[model samples]
Target: MASTLVSIAGYHVTEEIYNSSRTLVYRGYRETDHKPVVIKLLKNPYPSFSELLSFRNQYTIAKNLNLPLIIQTYSLEPYQNGYALVMEDFGGI
Candidate 1:
């Protein structure tokens, strides 16, 4: 989608891992820390308001979680017309 043409500050999108009408997940790295991270962004061409809210709520809950079993959320930022969720990368094991 249009997100492919955009870039997220402090992160380099190495490859796209998943894409759907609601979200896009990318294999990326944090520039400042040089750590691998997974970047999840809301797909462009805006989704419904309810969907957007759901996405935000999910991220909010993820950010607050402290369970060892769950991947920790790094940060969230405003993307093109949506939001981006950054989490620890867990690929290529």
Candidate 2:
């Protein structure tokens, strides 16, 4: 995602929390409810099929775990040319 991005759909991006060669993590809140969320996005504008699969797999696995220690998986939102993995923000930096 571009550094200038301020929001995504119903999310108001507050600040970018993490960045790596493969992903961009942002701290944001839902505009509708004001609940905190972490938005994980693919770094590549057009990710490969494998990368997409990994994102889906991770979300599926985490969502099914049903463990208290695991952060909640809110959604897999479509964005630009890829997707965003939205999760419960545990206030970690």
Candidate 3:
């Protein structure tokens, strides 16, 4: 796995909470409000175009969700050599 990312799109990555073949989830805080957030970073040199598309599709769906069971995505931003999906922090449940 790669070293923990320091920050992405202005959110400070405090700790890596999860990792898998496709993604890395981090505990972060929004720069402006200092609110906790979740950052999902795509692995560098994305394994495949389909994987990248899948991430974007998930973001689009999450962004429009209003259910309490679903975490809403705030935005997508380029990070490092890939992308990061900014989401509401659930404090790792």
User: 1 or 2: which has the higher TM-score?
Assistant: 2
Instruction: Give the alpha carbon lDDT tens digit for every residue of 1-93 in model 1.
Output: 555534888788888888777677889799998999988887765767887788789889998999998998988787866788888887742
Superposed on all Cα atoms, the candidates' RMSDs to the truth, in angstroms, are: 2.9, 2.3, 2.5
Candidate number achieving the greatest lDDT relative to the actual structure: 2
Clashing pairs in 1: none
Tens digit of per-residue lDDT, candidate 3, span 1-93: 887565565777888888887778888799999989988877656446777788889889888899989987889987766678899987764
List residue ranges in candidate 3 displaced over 4 A.
1-3
Distance from true location, Cα of 56 in model 1, Å = 1.2
- Candidates' TM-scores? 0.83, 0.92, 0.84
| CA error at residue 15 for candidate 2, angstroms | 0.3
Q: Model 1 lDDT vs. the true structure? A: 0.81
Candidate with better lDDT, 1 vs 3? 1
Q: Write the per-residue lDDT of candidate 2 for residues 1-93, one digit (tens) a residue.
A: 556654589999988889899999999898899999999999999999999999999889988887899899999999888889999999988
Error of 3 at 64 (Å): 1.2
TM-score of 2: 0.92
- Lowest lDDT sum, 10 consecutive residues, model 1, at 1-10
Measured by TM-score, the strongest candidate is 2
Q: On TM-score, who's better, 2 or 3?
A: 2
